[model samples]
Target: MAQDTARQAPPTAPATPARALLPLILPALVVGVGASLLLLLVNGVAERLQDLLWTNLPDALGVGRYSVLWMLVMLTATGVLVGLVVWKVPGHAGPDPATLSLHAVPLPPVVLPGLLLATVLMLAGGPSLGPENPIIVVNVGLALWLGHRLVPGLPGGVWGMLAESATIGALFGTPVAAALVISEALAGRPLKGALWDNVFAPLVAAAAGALTTALVAHPALDLGLPPLGRPDWGDLLAALVIAPVAGLVGLCAVYAFPYVHGGFRRLGHPMLALPAGGLVLGLLAALGGHLTLFKGLAEAAELARNPQGNSAGRLAVLAVVKVAALLVAASSGFRGGRIFPSVFIGVALGLCAHACVPAVDPALGVAAGVLGLLLAITRQAWVSLFTAAVIVASPTVLAVLCIASLPTWLLVTGRPQMQLREDGSPVR
Candidate 1:
């Protein structure tokens, strides 16, 4: 019998040792922490920029007087600037903002620096987009890139998972938003081991990020809205009335948002574009009153604080006008996160909903109403729930708000979206 060379036993390959894995994981975590730290430093800067834009734009632009053509001119001007930035640096430009969460796709490490610049420019310049997504994406991408470059032998997926969790955790200043976003984004993907991997790194990163975010900028997330005294029979009735009214308003905002966006995109010519949107926004602000312009967060918070000051007519008017303004400001050409304005619109609408029905607790009704709209349009129930809780300033309301958010979300998901996509893409 001849010995067959083909049948020779295969040589055993070396198994990956714990020591080898340590280098890859360690560096990636370090990069992630650095990114998180950077993000934490910038969060308040972004917030302050957003505040100035929302607070000052209307008065500065001489809103409420511009004609339609003038508004178009204003919009065109903004379009030009936005177009220039997007053209020069497309990577940092975030996903269509009117949709759900502030989600950004991972890109090359080179893009992170540019993205950071773009975020500051857009938010500071008064484009109606948010900063959190860019903050998260840049961190995540940079961490993974550094990991790969440093340890070429490591599994890319491991670095990716860590980067993702840490960046998001840092960006939001809380693990809750990061966790909720992860869960929603992975809706259909195979679970596998993501449950552990996607979550743990962020918790670690967030711990550091939150401490830094607070120490550096002192972000106050909890506003402490009062809790609702247990739902009475009146509260149940209030809920019914709210379902239809809020649903209609939410539907319209979702439906109308694109047309607002399209007008600017259509101009195509950037110079002639921004001024047009500006003029339109100016006039609308004038027509709807000052609250009609800018991001609307302050206005919403004010209305929630003093709902009785505005008559039923004013709140009702605000509910319609603010939504239109946001759609226009956001859609026409300005860039910034939809998160603040969306919450504002929801809170304002909630206040209006309370006015519609006399029996409901104004605060509770306000909380429920705002929660409903955010849940529908953003489609992130967890964020919506927290946001509503933050607004009311009460733990007790959080429980009821949580319950109310679900039915509202279900109602919204059932509808056809006219503009914002479930996955964060916009129609345009």
Candidate 2:
């Protein structure tokens, strides 16, 4: 007992670099591989289930894929199903998802099954959220539990950092995205040494996770937008105007999210609140059509592929309905992340801008639009910039986006976040 206590006692100074390196590397690799495999399983099952729900059953029923009646019925049923899990399942699926951020304290191991089940239902049933939060929580919990047993001396928050980094890396299909996100998150905090010293292990884990997903599952974050040839003054002007417009659109939803969340929580039971949210989401889906379904990645691709096919008015409706769907799913008893849907919302806004003007460069408009929405929703500059730029897949507009994001940041900086306060109060 004395030896164990002494091992945990505060050191006179930080460990030497040589000693720190191996300790960081080995655990990161283990956690990274574990996280990667878990995410793969979650995504795989969800995809198969989605195919069954939206494809096989509908075909068997002779119903059209986007039929309003079918979607309405299926979504509400999903709500009942997931609500049962949330209410009756052990661990109650951890905590209210609306109160969670991209990262949070590790949940207990017992929470894993119910959380994953609820998440799969949300995804397969066509909620506007993504697998990010649920999957991250799973990874964090597993990593913490494993790390404690295997590497008792690792610093606090190290496993969480690794889990978050690995998840981001897997989701976006790149270690660099995780690095940028972590850098933005860690920017203002007190530091003990060079940033890279702390970041190195997580980066290693992120790379492993990113590479594993790419090699095994075929990474899917790309938007496949047309390339921008060169920068022009017209593009610059459009970015300055359009990015903030997207930010404004996102801010509107951000403001509404907490209120909606609080209202649902007042019901005081997942069984009641989730079905109600599902019904409203179904109604919104009926209004917005099938394009509003899912996490928005595939639909965003569809939108980008044929911008000319959708009228400007249609694009605007898509953005609004998606924002509404996102809020409803998140505030209800659904378990998921906000980033993927936010990307879809940003794409809709950008496409709307381009459709309305028919003058702004398409690629530039899409990139700027994403930049603004990500900035407003995440309040993380590096993440917003990287996400926007990567989707556009061009270097020409990065400078303009950087400049455009500055003003948008001001608009979102002090504003209320989308997550609810723990006391069940609205953010505002």
> Best candidate per TM-score, number?
2
Cα distance off (Å), candidate 1, residue 189: 2.8
The digit string of per-residue lDDT tens for model 1 on 399-428 reads 566556556666777565544554434543
The 0-to-1 C-alpha lDDT of every candidate, in the order given, reads 0.59, 0.87
Which regions of candidate 1 deviate over 4 angstroms? Answer: 1-80, 87-101, 109-115, 125-128, 150-172, 194-198, 292-294, 418-428
lDDT of 2 by residue, 292-377 (tens): 99998989999999877788999999999999999899988799888889899889888888899998878888889999988887
Q: Locate the minimum summed-lDDT window of 10 residues in model 2.
A: 11-20
After superposition, which runs of candidate 2 have C-alpha atoms over 4 Å from their true positions?
1-16, 426-428
- Model 2 steric clash pairs: none
Residue 301, candidate 1: how far off, in angstroms? Answer: 2.9
Predicted structure 1: lDDT: 0.59
